[model samples]
Target: MRIADHATWDRGFPVKYLLVQEDEDGVEQLWGRCTGVEGFFVDPVPPPREILTLRGCRPDGLLSEVLAEPDVSLRCLGDVCVEVCDDEKPVQWWTLADAVVVAHQPHQADPERYDIVLGAGVRSEESFFELPATSHFELFAGTRVAAASAGRCSGVDGLFKARVDLAPVPMELIGCEPAEPLLAALRRPRRSERDWAYLLVLDRHGAVMASRSVGLAITGTRPSVLGGILVDITLTDGGNDRPSLAARPIWAEWYQGSPTEPNLWAPYDS
Candidate 1:
């Protein structure tokens, strides 16, 4: 299945949609729908609309002055930490990074393992009022990959699984280890053809993250809708032994004649 469109709700927001189609033997066969978490950020309070005139204020000096000023509110979403400037003077200049702070919380009663860092501001929005500087500020959150399921056929047995190693690595990679007899089972083809394909990656907990109705071609036919197919793609481990899997399903369909397209038929002898 190929994605017809992938769209997000808005800038600095996380909502999104994935549209897919499946075709086999030149005919449309099946479809799939999947949804999951995406990361985004919003700044409710942007720099003041009116520009503040700093006749001789050096850029650095202006920022430093603003740092000491009051009326600025900074909050970290992941750790839920809020910092407010108490100085009465207005801030003249400020670096985006300096204004933001990550709140690292230690495990209660235990100092080794961190409970969680609240510095992440995914899906959070900020607001700005009349201020002392003219600057563009952007909020960004790291990307995360999650899985969701669409439609499936009972004839397509077997599960898809994947896992992500928390450990660091040079590059991301996905590996597939099919059970023995995989080749024979797949080679002994059927007359109807397998239109839908599934890719499953097993996580540490054995849960599977699957992408279904992926598009692929088979037997020299270029169907409009295609299903997922498995290919041997390697990823650099970067020095880490463990890695997560990226799996998706492929579906194919036979072609049906369109209203304007001419139909060709072979003569049948009776």
Candidate 2:
């Protein structure tokens, strides 16, 4: 487990770390403990030098470039992996394995930053899960996962694979615009008004690993086959909520749509 109370700005300077905190009025303020590094910024606000100590740090998707560097240490907190920055001991940490439910809470100051709230052992239907707040998993919620395998496909060279897990209900895929080159290589004729399905691939812990929308064609009568051009994968960085994918994999599972979750309307005939 890695914990951090400060942010690191990796410029070629003696002091590369700074503490970011909110004042009593809830405004973000930068604080420094070191001396003789005033050339980098306008004001070097001072704080209690004695209490300013380093500790273990957590690295998220923003640090993807940094994590790719040679010999960066890493550790896993539950299913999420984080980069190790310093030798200091971590002050706090949490595990997803112990969580019964996970809720996403966006940071007030930074819109991109969100904290993953894990519900304790108790399971309740009337909690934040029932709130009107946008539930990211609303599409597949209350639906069962059906396992289907995909083979290594050709002509999908440039496009990355993004798996869409489904429930029993059929739903439409939203927010996908494939490049012209990919559309031209497909065997079927492309159309502007064609219906597409939005898909999401989640890790075992229910963290969104990747998502995309693809124009799928359903064929046959009873046992129908679904075909679609693989779209470019949109990898997510759920802030400190989940770990990022190391690399894209081939053929993620696509579940069967159910009527219960009407979000994804079933296009196949009975």
Candidate 3:
């Protein structure tokens, strides 16, 4: 995403949509994890206006900043936490080695995980507004961070990132011997023509509930939509095989005195 005007500081200008130049692309078939099913997914349309920060910039070559996906909110990254699941365990805690601040995904065929490529998990530090001045963690390439279903909000169908760093795992917080099959799934990868992919880091017992945006809209004069749809999608952890499931049409729209942010989108495909 590009800023409307980089010349000024806070409240200077609104942020534009992604894919302005020939190189900007959300479907990273050329290039491009999850705590739960909520950690995966994206919106194909112009994403909701969001604010992002460079985690650990590379001094020479490697670029750590990546586009996770717009389905995952940038501001919400402050409350995310990583965790692992097993047959004998509820949810085991894990540290976020890498952080995925914001991004957007657009995969419809997938009923489970489809937004991993968009990069919308947690900030891996704290609230988006409360990040430390000094940068740490990996700065060259993307790092793997395992999180849990708890990361996504159930009511809003959005995610909640942790504002503080990951806490230590209890000595007894481990599960029975590792389930190789489950472990393999957690670290699995996806392939798609659109490239809006995500890994199914779930056991065979749950269903993944996801919601993808199908339209593009912008409103209001504020640099950003003043509290548009907080996309409160607390992605619950379940699989397609779950005995029961529910879904509803969630809409997001905004309007104000003047359109502050300039929105853009590449007419790539239908």
Candidate 4:
């Protein structure tokens, strides 16, 4: 498993690595252990710390410039190939036949660093056939197994949702502007008067403030898709609080109206 943690300054810097861990309760913990060397900023220009090769069936020039370089290490635990490289150096690479990989990344300025991990596993092959007056017989024959049976066979089977411990970083408000770019991308033309909700805090200068998980919303749209013309907005404010303000013209979903029956909503919460 490969795991990593990193941060970027407003001035830009090299992508530093960190350590991360998840407890039984699914809480993510982050620790920073390495400081990036100066002159590591490659935001406008590519860095020289890692590079890509054609050795492991990875065709050269077949990958994206942003994804080709090894910004972080990666590994596979089962029947999967993995390669890790930076701008100029190849860090680590491996393949697994039947295993899992876990990657961890840590937040910056932590007491420790964690690696981002990815896990993989392959299913065993099995064959079955019905007995009859035949010369050959299948290696395995039986009724169709239920999905529950396979789940039971797994040693530790369950979806592993990643947890990230976002550090309290200084967020600068760039500006409060309409999120027209976002709405255009969504291809929703009928949306009218979509405005974000939140405070727009700024720093000492005219520069905007920045923070994590600050509530922002867009309200204005006809009820339509889900029943009537209703404004559908998404709020993403779940990190530490900092100086910030809401921007306007936030992208939102257009709901048509309420549901015909309240029972339909029950399954969603469950």
Candidate 5:
């Protein structure tokens, strides 16, 4: 899917919709409604009016104070944790690594288990704010990777599954493994012209009920250069306004035990 296709939802600004339901086994299933019509899913639009895309930056390069300026958000999806500033008009964001701090409840059991929470002002070590009463999220201690991989099977045993729908394009999912060097999943044959890639990583979780995707503009794709990839940053006159997801029916059908407004497409699609 072309990056331009994501502008349909709210004009040029895209919104990410999420619906969650529990299965008969009581495990929660998340039905994510994202932008992109032809199988490619871009992260939600950023808050900044203008985005400056940079290509060929070292993936492992230490972000400098100057380059990591205010009002800019970066979109690099994978197992990495991110910090999005909701209060800022331009929403300064960055990939969170050593800066992330997960705290476990004093009496909490199995502190390693966690859930994915997506929204503005999600409390992290680097970002903190007073959340509105209507907000829903979970704060627990564990590595971001551990949270994403919990309650799933297959892949690297304790690893998590990453379902990426960037069709008609070849992309790689690379990350580090326990006691092993950096690893990259082999690019599998596309199931169809609209197929999504499923790779394994040691990562989001039960506590993590939701999180917003990043807005990205990709002019082209090429292999990583010096462990870095390049992108063209587009800037806009974005305001400080934020968008909230309302509960909506994912399907018209209603089951006996379904809520008044059913949000999940089906209980078993995942």
Candidate 6:
């Protein structure tokens, strides 16, 4: 299983790697031992790096840019990605088979900078990141892989098939923007304005904001789908407990409004 940990600048440099093994018995064990590791800003996300967007990782929806060199296998991603979830199990877990390896180039050359664009095409709607199955998968670079040749991808264009057993990446509701581009691609409905609710789904991390409000009859993010017209948040004060926000928020009172996009709405059969 691949384990993913955020590289935080404020935390320190040279991010560490931890490996956990879960046998058939369901027993979990921890493994920690790595060397010559380092990281920096991934761009777009935050400093510590929450969501990584490697440009041109997977240029084509279904193809990976074969490395121009040899001995460069796809296992380069340390072979696994542990998403770093909390005590609670992650929302999703799955394996990726035969993915593409867009391209590779040393960062600093001398010391060898390995961070490169890692992309995967979406094959199933049941994919993460409300983006879609056809969208590319984003990832951060890790450990070195030892394959056979480190040459160009002309001879073996589609031969460098890869498998990524991705573990869930830890994610929290950090920010939410009232508008988004993906939000513009949802299915809206026409109603009395009293029967709808606003919903937010977090399958994979968002490319832009923490959350985007998309008006639609079917509300879903990636793995999890939620639908409604409103989301209610309440804060309770002193009790036997310290000040904290409620674990669950209440949805809005019954709402009945047609899904509107500025001045347009999908036509409904009356």
Top lDDT: which candidate number? 4
> How much lDDT does each candidate structure score?
0.24, 0.24, 0.24, 0.25, 0.24, 0.25
lDDT of 2 at 58: 23
User: How badly does each model clash, as a count of residue pairs?
Assistant: 53, 14, 41, 78, 28, 35
Better of 3 and 4 by TM-score: 3
Q: Which stretches of candidate 3 lie above 4 Å from their native place? A: 1-73, 97-100, 106-113, 117-270
Q: Write the per-residue lDDT of candidate 2 for residues 72-142, one digit (tens) a residue.
A: 33321222211111234322221112221123334455544433332222212221222122211100111
The predicted structure with the larger lDDT, 5 or 6, is: 6
Error of 1 at 52 (Å): 48
TM-score of candidate 6 versus the correct structure, residues matched by position: 0.17
The TM-scores, one per candidate, come to 0.16, 0.14, 0.17, 0.15, 0.16, 0.17
The positional error of residue 17 in candidate 2, measured at the CA in angstroms, is 40
How does model 2 fare in lDDT? Answer: 0.24
Give the Cα-based TM-score of candidate 5 against the true structure.
0.16
Q: Write the per-residue lDDT of candidate 5 for residues 130-220, one digit (tens) a residue.
A: 3333322211122554533112101111111122322222222121111111111112222223121111111011122223222221223
Give the winner by TM-score: 2 or 3. 3
TM accuracy, model 2 = 0.14
In terms of lDDT, the poorest run of 10 residues in model 3 is 215-224
lDDT score at residue 43, model 5, on the 0-100 scale: 32
Please give the RMSD to the true structure for each candidate, in Å: 23.9, 29.1, 26.2, 25.4, 24.0, 23.9
The better-scoring model by TM-score among 3 and 5 is 3
Error of 1 at 61 (Å): 49
Report the poorest 10 consecutive residues by lDDT, candidate 1. 246-255
User: Which runs of model 1 end up more than 4 angstroms from their true locations?
Assistant: 1-174, 185-191, 215-270
